[model samples]
Target: MTEGAVPLISARGISKSFAGVEVLRDVDLDLMRGEIHALLGENGAGKSTFAKILAGVHRPTRGSLALNGQPVEIADPRAAQKLGITLIHQEPISFPDLSVAENLVLGRAEDGWWSSVPWSEMTREARKYMDLLGVRIDVTKPMRGLSIADQQMVEIARALVSDSRLIIMDEPTAPLTPKEVETLFGIARRLRDEGRTIIFISHRLEEVRAICDRVTIFRDGNKISTETIDKVSDADIIRLMIGRPLKEYMHKLNTSIGEVALEVQGLTLPGVFNDISFSVRRGEIVGLGGLVGAGRTDVARAIFGVAPAESGTVKVHGKAV
Candidate 1:
């Protein structure tokens, strides 16, 4: 951002509290025009809370917001949309049963009180936005069956349809494959080139360094520092986020392995997962590691009964669940 130029959006003295527990306190941030600004912090660092305030999902307990140098009150999500702001959630927030085209223009439909739904026009417009993002999908299909990457693309298309100047993308790459992540980054760069500001929130530091111009680190509801990405190293950023050197937290511990506490036998969920078997001892801390769409989360979900496996036996301390 240029030294003398006014910010595109200015948040001053922002503070938020939920049930008397403060989540953010006297926070300040400036988002410049035509730049992808990254917001980085650990979980419960109040990053999302700050973004939600900007998106009108939550009002600040005390603060002020200025868009284009004028004070404004964003009372709700609809008002935020009217102000040319949009939030693309980590999980696509759209009607599961609605068609892709319908979800793309869900809230900003143009149908009047007596006018008929222009399905053809809607489809065409949605296709145009999808094409701009280089995403090819059948716009007539329901959103329930679409891949996470495809759903994220649809959310970006919705932002384009709404003519949003500032788009807040919260963990947009969390569930996307590497190829999909690169594709999404390309689209984000295109949006930046077209003079749109983006608030990119992510845990992946490498992605932030690759795409963002500036980064703001938050810690325990406080703004730690805001620096140009090029001026900071990864270690520097990590220290700022966690308040300690990385080496201090890298040492591993040894523990005695006890009897099996969690055992899964022949866990299968058809195409989702196949014959997954694992056992964790009472004193063991097992990590489930996988790439996006690798069915790791699916296996966890099935074991937890959120989505029961078609054929599996989950035993907790020797008793089947």
Candidate 2:
């Protein structure tokens, strides 16, 4: 940030509570223009609460927010949009049945209710923004058929069309593939270069280090520290986020492996999974690993009979279940 220049978004003494339980407390932050600012914290650390306050999803219990040094109140999401603030959620929110162009202009006031719909103009505008993000998709297609990555691109395109200056992205990469993440990062960098400020809320330290200019860590409803990305090490960020050194949380335990306690053979869930076989022995731990939509949860659901497998055999302690 240049010396003496006003921060794009300045938050002071911000606090928030839900049902009388405080989630954020007396937090202060300054977001610079054209900078990708990363917010890092563990779950319930108040980072998300702060982002919501900025996005107008929630109001601060006590505090003040300023845009370019001018005080302002974001009463709701609509107000935030009017102020060029938009929140891109982890799951892109769109009407599944609606066309991409329709979703892009869903809540905008340009197309009055009494006026006839401007389908051609809407499609052209949607294409313009999508093109800016370098995403190519049929604007007339229903959002239901698009991938999560594509849905996110549409959401971002919507933001761009709204002329949002301060975009808060909440876990945008959680459901995306590595390739998708890179594409999103490229778009974010391009936006930042264009003088838009971005608030990147994520737990991914490596991603933050890769793309962010500055980082702020939160722990137990308080702001821990804000530093230039290059000035802080990953270990330092982790320590601040968890309020302890990484080693303190590392636990190692040894247990003798017993007979198989639960076993599954040839678990098949039709289109979901096929020939999934695994066993858990007593006194042992196991983990199912996969990317998003990898059927790990579906396999567990099938084994538990929540959604019974189409073809599978389950045994408990050598007896078929």
Candidate 3:
């Protein structure tokens, strides 16, 4: 961003509440043009709330917004879209029955209710944007059958089709493969080169460092710091996020595993998961590690009888549960 130039989006004293409970306090941020700005925060840190406010999902309880030095009120999502802003959620909210091309153009003004459907044009446009992102998918395919990564690509293509000046991506790479994430980063860089600003909300520090120019850290409903990415190391960013030194927050102690406290044998959840077996000792903390939708949560739920496995034997202290 050039010195003394007006920001593309200026947020001042932004605050939000829900049902009398405050979730975001007074915060100010300035988003520059043609830059990938990262919003870093843990869960419930008000970063999402701030992004939603910019996307028109939530209104600030006490604040003012300015676009290019002009005051504006984002009444809703449509209003935000009109101002060249769009938010792509963590989970791609798309119509399962709709074709990929139709979903891409859904809610777009050009696809008017009174006009005849333009299947060929929409498919061509969708294909063009997907190609720009280096993704090749059948635009005629139903959205229900697409993978999470592909669906996210479609959402990004839609943003491009809308000519959104400022796009907010919320955890976009969570469900993506490493190769898919690479493609996304390339597309983001291309968009930035084209003078479109992006607000990337992510938990991964490495990703923020790789693709972002500047980062804003949020904690406990407040903005902690905003600095050039090169100026802050991973430890520095982590310290700011947790409000402490990294060593203090993470302390590892050697310990011996005791006798088995719980055991699972041949746990199965139909097509979801099969033949999952594990044992947890009394003094062990086993992490179910994997990416999103990797059945980690399902395994925990099944072991606790929240969602009983279709076929499995669980024993607690050598007794069947």
- How many clashes does each candidate structure show, in the order listed? 0, 0, 0
True lDDT of residue 153, candidate 3: 85
| TM-score (C-alpha, index-matched) for candidate 1 | 0.92
lDDT of 3 by residue, 1-321 (tens): 799989999999999999999989989999999899999988999999999999999999999999999999998999998898989988899999989988887747654731455778878877888888778999999999988888888888888878899999998998888998998899899989988999999999989999999999999999999999999899999999999998899988898889999999999999788999999998998888877778999999999899999998999999999
For candidate 1, lDDT tens digit of each residue in 265-306? 999999899999999998888998876679999999999999
Alpha-carbon lDDT, every model: 0.90, 0.91, 0.90
Question: C-alpha displacement of 205 in model 1, angstroms?
Answer: 1.0
Q: Give the 10-residue window scoring lowest on summed lDDT in candidate 3.
A: 107-116
Pairs that clash in candidate 3: none
TM-score between candidate 3 and the true structure = 0.92
Q: Estimate each model's TM-score.
A: 0.92, 0.93, 0.92
* Stretches of candidate 1 exceeding 4 Å from the true structure: 110-117, 269-272, 290-298, 304-310, 319-321
